[model samples]
Target: MPNDFLSPADQAAAEQQQRLLAAQVVRHDQLPTTIRTVAGVDVAYAQHSDQLVAAAVLLDAATLEIRHTAVVRLGAAFPYIPGLFSFRELPPIQQALAQLPEAPDLVICDGQGLAHPRRFGLACHLGVATGLPTIGCAKTRLVGSYHALGHPRGSTAELVLDGEVVGQALRTQPGINPLFVSIGHRVSLATACHWVLRCAPTYRQPETTRAADHLVNQELHRLLAAALPPAPDGM
Candidate 1:
């Protein structure tokens, strides 16, 4: 994608190494109860460059079996802005999504959704762009506050926006940090939390998303190592 495609306001922030828009809501909905395939998306950055890498891995929602994987590498023009994370990450994510051989019944993004300040985060942006049902499953809270829930992994608390409930904070593993689950587009916060807990076997993060995070980071490190020249001073 070209930098010109990014909004002029967003582009101005990019040039200064700053970001605009903490968050905003784009869209959302509920997915089919009997979901077949779920895709996990994650991004990793190069050691010292504007290069951003994204990977999408599809898996059987029920069996937790991997089906297909896609990857994208692109120059990241957006800065490390807290609220405007989607703007920085969405381009690479879109590329990876486009390369997927098969469309997934659902997509889970490693970021925020309605849980964000602007209500639109990485997951929401991508969901709107692809017109796919997506869920934002973040390892930590992006905005808002929540009362602690039951100790069990399935316990949850509503995420409110302007006095209206928009998402949830779910405890995926008992005694572990809860995940901020929110509707991206075409999904519900309740169903988002339900699927997240169901997909997690024993970790705080769901298997699919955890695996995707690892995969992208691995590729990132691999590329960085490849770019390094062998020791030339001696050996």
Candidate 2:
């Protein structure tokens, strides 16, 4: 992929980096007992273009009120590689997150972490780089298989891959689809799932993810509209 920010790496080299990073992923607890502030990170891509927008939304964990938000427009430096999506998305996300007024105690990623094919997903990548507790709260499974969970909220099933437990399929709302929750870094899998459910009281997706998604999409649309040429007056 054509990248302006990072150096090019072949598949073998990239997977090797994933393996090394996987070893550094901390699945144990490494955070404060109480999480007052939470953050969510997501990226939205412009159709058929490398242009993209990333957003970081920080919220009051108790009230789900948005506290701070940061958004940035930039081009991705890597292709949509299956296990290495962090390379394409994290640069802009990290930039936006760095601009936040206050760093959140915990970060929820709209992607995978330990549930990845390499066990090193965007959440892990960002947490390690930023030294923050992170959780991967994916809308869909990136990898792993799980037995069907109960239909009621708080129901959970183990997500296992390669005969190892990596994450959970959790029901956040009654009769709704389950979320794929996993340990990113500095947080245990159980804590990740607990936070995800706590942040998602009404909706299926956590407030952090919803807030960041809304911000990124709004920013991307504004940018696209601004890039449009003026319409001819005589038409």
How accurate locally, in lDDT, is each candidate? 0.78, 0.89
Best lDDT among the predictions, by candidate number: 2
lDDT of 2 at 106: 96
- Scored by lDDT, model 1 comes in at 0.78
What is candidate 2's lDDT per residue for 1-235, written digit by digit as tens?
3232233367777777778768888899999888899998999987777987999999998899998989998887788878878888888888899999988899999999899998999899888878899999888988989998899999999999999999999999999999999999999999999899999999999999999999998988888778889768895
Across 121-161, the per-residue lDDT of candidate 1 in tens digits comes to: 77777776677888889988878878878898788888777
lDDT for residue 180 in candidate 1, whole number 0-100? 87
